[model samples]
Target: MPLTTRRRALSTLGAALAGAVALPAGQALAAERTPPVRPLWRAHAHNDYEHPRPLLDALDHRFGSVEADVFLVDGQLLVAHDAVDLDPARTLESLYLAPLAARVRAHHGSVYRGARTPLQLLIDLKTEGASTYLELDRQLSRYRQLFTTYTHGRVRRGPVTAVVSGDRAARTPLAAQTVRRAFYDGRLTDLGSTEASFAALISDNWTSHFTWQGVGSFPDAERLKLRTIVGAAHERGQRVRFWATPDVPGPARDALWGELLAAGVDHLNTDDLAGLEAFLDAHGTD
Candidate 1:
């Protein structure tokens, strides 16, 4: 189907699904009961845990990717932006893993009903990488069936693909593992340095590479550079995402998002789930 037609169908289907489904924690909604909506795979929710409903909100928006910052305090992985704001009640399991497992089950394997693509869960580690990742590995093992796994040299697709971000030290343990439930989030420097099974995503700070904030014309050189980066990553079968972009609701954000889309960037990071969803809908994204 045409991209425009697919998006229109997705919007209508999504509206119906949202009204019909209630994704409460640990409860499974019958996704098969409603027609599936094509998710905005390029729409990524940055700081997704901060939303009123955490993972559920992103799902309701039909976003294919969501980011969570995790801090390892004591033994539990707590979800919070900063240590001071950490709430013991909010945990990685309660907030993300368990809920995702339930949803995936309801959808019959995929996170979205009738969709084959795995949902991207970008888990940003806030504490020391080595020790924290050890705990993370242990936790992810419990839900191995729910996550894309790497065993020996092969990758098995699952309902969700967890990519570990933040704290470069985590790479050490991750590399040592013969089998893992998560993949490493790579930076520009790591591009093409490792196989896609190891580094599935190439991410970097938007400000570090580009001066354009979407206010004016994008520099010809920078535009080329952006495309080149994306091309190089894609050539190696790695997806690309750039954070720290201007996310305020305005033309500037839309302009940057448009350019990123034009560049074939895989994920558009935004805290405003509704804004990005509307933008993608208006642009007739598939």
Candidate 2:
């Protein structure tokens, strides 16, 4: 099936999943505490801002990571994929930050009540990387306790870990931070170029490096390349995620997801929230 057709079908599936899985009661009851659920550590919600419920939807399925693209507009960070789709009310603080803060407090310093792993919040840059990241740093400072931080030579764990992606220029300013609440997201080439403290994640488009689309048997050479990249990233204590892979709902997509897991890929990127949740749950990744 064509990628577009698969996306449409997956979007429909995602909508249904969002509707069926309600928000956790812990979020609604900030004062009342509830035990945290097991997190799907490998699950990463791609373009999570597009979801009807944003962070909540992924949390409902216990996703460990979520991506949000933001444009630095009029001194405000607005969440959207493109300039034409920007909405004034869809500020980063409203859609992600504040809600996360509330949830962390509700869960008592953890995104998923008692889960030790901090949730990964990937902020893909949609504007100039340096200036936008500086502004983002300012915003992140307001919720210092809510995010993981790196200072001097020590790393402090918080409920959420913000990793900056997109425009490569952000790396310059990010590298200069003496104390930063956000980390950099690098490409596969950056695997051994820097330490995990600087670039916490290594992410790139899967199609750019591979010719296969999960059709028949994956080429042995390509499979080796995939495993090599993952192994290198893991050796450095950095996580790996490849976006723009097969997201169409079918055997091909399932096959690709399976390969990713078997190869030790840290994240399974998908727009279909429930689709990934079910796949991981069934496969025992939960």
Candidate 3:
């Protein structure tokens, strides 16, 4: 090789090395950073506590909402679907509150990193509404600013939003709260009549309202009814969710979910975590 050609090659290599060395550590990291994963905000893990790993399983799937059934026993709020299945070790504070607090701290005041919107924690009360909510309030108070608060006429967003479901009687007390850590979940009847400030979500049994079970094709009128319901709720500044629909792993679940998405339903309730995750990804709903 010619002497000048060799000198030029060496100088080029030296300049490249100098540029690399001059790069800031944080800037180098920024160059290597991958875009954040889109959160599946519409996926609601029904009976999330029933899973083997509970909250961890749903978080791994990037689920935005999770439901836990709680029973008030001897001033302790225990999480379980039924009274017969209640376990002392599965208290609300242990399974949810502590872990959520730790996660918010770890993520720097958000459930998801670099995101301001909070994750939804749906607490279904299986016991006496008023008494259970009072105890739940006490437990929530210990966490300070962990859960979202409705103060005066505005909602102060936090790391997590707790929506109270189950026990129709709970509505009376939940509505009466001047300042509370949670919002109430209403039924279909309350869709247009209810305010979003009081009832944040409208949930009902899918089987009760529509006869189409995601079989061959959804009836035209039934689809219209579903869309109507969703539209009404959206107009009223509320979200819609229906349980008791098909959950089995098959085309039926996919069809129903597709229909729900097309109708603009806010949350898709499901017990199968991976199944719903796959469905939502395929449709790009996140």
Candidate 4:
């Protein structure tokens, strides 16, 4: 073979090898350029303690938010939807706090894997508002190292956020307390009207009257209304959530979920975990 021809063939092989070597680096760069996956607004388990597995169910279902209604019984925070249903074995610490603490310790203090956003543990005050909250403050203080504390709208991770719902009277004491870990979930009416009374989220009941559904397009009037609510809450740096939404099969659920997403509602409340997961996945919101 001619020396020039041999030299040309060697150069071609060297160029091919160099291209092969650069491919992975280029691919890695492209992968890095791709935005990190946005964490899903979790499938919130409403009254999760009522479920057979409780914490296990929430974790298995990949819920980002979980709720437990508690009544202070004999100085123990017992989980129950109704005041009469309180069970001693189902203490808030046993059902939620302890497990969550263990998980946070395991995951280096975050709930979801690779998740920077803290999981939310909403406690609906089911007993007398004042004493219950006082006890709650004590119990939460025990796990203070595990809760996300916020003051003047700044958030930092410890374990999970404790949001108080249900008792309207709890708000006053909560606002008065100098302690900083727990936050209030207020009603929609309180959003635009109230002073910065220490609420981190506003949640309301979504009625059948709400018109927007996940169909071809969202309705303008309803969209505008929702946007106003979310905007007002966001202005105060408070997140928005809704409960009592239609849970049965079909478009009604989809419509509400769709509209909520479009309006940038912070949390989607649902008792049906599988349904919420499917809806979020379908809408590309999860």
Candidate 5:
């Protein structure tokens, strides 16, 4: 073939190759720009057992932190908001632990697809603190290989991290355990006082009396209070979350969420997953 013809052919081939290579990179860039697969502040479902679908409801709501109140009955861990409400069929393992374990396995140890961080499992014990924790330890041991374990200051990769809430007596003994899995969830009052090195997160009630609105104009006093709380928790290298925040379907909820986001609160307590997702979409960091 003539030189001119050869040159034209070569150029065409180069263009095709370039297009092939650039296509994937361009597609990848688009995927990267897509909204994050997970929420900014971890969405927590309080008393998840109370929800109609229980564990499924929490998962469907994209709740990164799920609360299960369990009572120990006849060597079984029954899940319920109160002891009288306990059902034999709704054991902690059946309702949550087992499903969570299977899910972590299915999702490669994270609730969110492609998530690197383990989802938080906040188990609120309602039985005798010591016995409940002991039984919990036994049950958790069955899935020891699937929980996030920490030592000193390092986090180990695993399915999830189980943090005990509701029973204060469980904290000291839990801390004394030599086990790698499981940790304590501390309260706001214990924020600056705990010597427990493995307390994963601090959670508390954010009452309606607390004044925080999403009006882009937070009260200076409340802002300072929030900053102090979040800063102190972060200083210990732990995350902070609040429950019982306004769940009302209006400005009240938005305001509190806004302030919580502004204050750098790690998790936002909300049963309204779609609402939270919309808000995060509007003001997400990503």
Candidate 6:
């Protein structure tokens, strides 16, 4: 079968696995086609699950990437920032996978209509990495058509690319997998050491590495360092991102965001979806 046909088949299978929550048959297909919305490809929704509608909110804001923190509870992948916030109802599948699967079907194989670029789903493991990732792997396997997959040294792109982040312990198991529906989120330490097939994203804490917090002018040396890091990662076909940056809405944040854009950062971490969306729009970076 052709790749597109295979994707559609898998999507139908995935919808069946999701039960009633899945989109009604032909509903997505029959829905009117909307003009392709310009997505802020570099906009990363930090703690996206905290938003009122999880994935839907980010999609509404045209964010190309969204992060969801998950914990392993009772053999299930629960979406939460911490253990205390865990709720049985908010599962990875319900909050992310199922919805994404439906959207892909709606768009006839892409998250965004008329666009083949995959939306990035950053899954941050909040519990023990190994166990949590094992559970995550199982969940992702069930919706295989919804995620980008690496199989036997080859990668097949899907509508959404799931990048596994947080919980360093998960690294071992992720590395051990010869085939998986998710990729690892690497840090600067893994820069050139890993391949783009495995570690597709290079993310780290901005505060831990830089002294500048988007105040005044970025230091000359630090600026060079930032660009160098981005350049190195791009050279290896991997993307770079940093969390813990000044997210406050102000000139400082704008300055930092501008600098990041200029430096070719792949994703900008922010809780303010509207803020980033507006910024990216104003700059015509979307």
What lDDT tens digits, residue by residue, belong to model 5 across residues 232-277? 9989878898887877668867877877888889888776766776
Best by lDDT: 1
Error of 4 at 270 (Å): 1.1
lDDT tens digits by residue: candidate 6, 155-197: 9999999999989999999999999999999999998899999
Return the lDDT, model 6, position 262.
97
Give one digit per residue, the lDDT tens place, for model 3 in 31-105.
Answer: 347455577889999999999988889988999999999999998999999889988999998999888887776
What lDDT is obtained when candidate 1 is compared to the true structure?
A: 0.93
The C-alpha TM-scores of every prediction are: 0.89, 0.88, 0.87, 0.79, 0.79, 0.90
**Candidate 2, after superposition: displacement of residue 155 in Å?**
0.9
Model 6: lDDT of residue 119? 96
lDDT for every model? Answer: 0.93, 0.91, 0.88, 0.77, 0.76, 0.92
lDDT of 4 by residue, 169-233 (tens): 78887887665778888887788765433677788877643554454566677778889988999
User: lDDT: which is higher, 4 or 6?
Assistant: 6
Q: Backbone clashes per model, in order?
A: 0, 0, 0, 3, 2, 0
* Positional deviation of residue 9's Cα in model 2 after best superposition, in angstroms: 56
Clashes of 3: 0
RMSD of 1: 11.3
Error of 2 at 256 (Å): 0.6
> How much does candidate 1 score in TM-score?
0.89
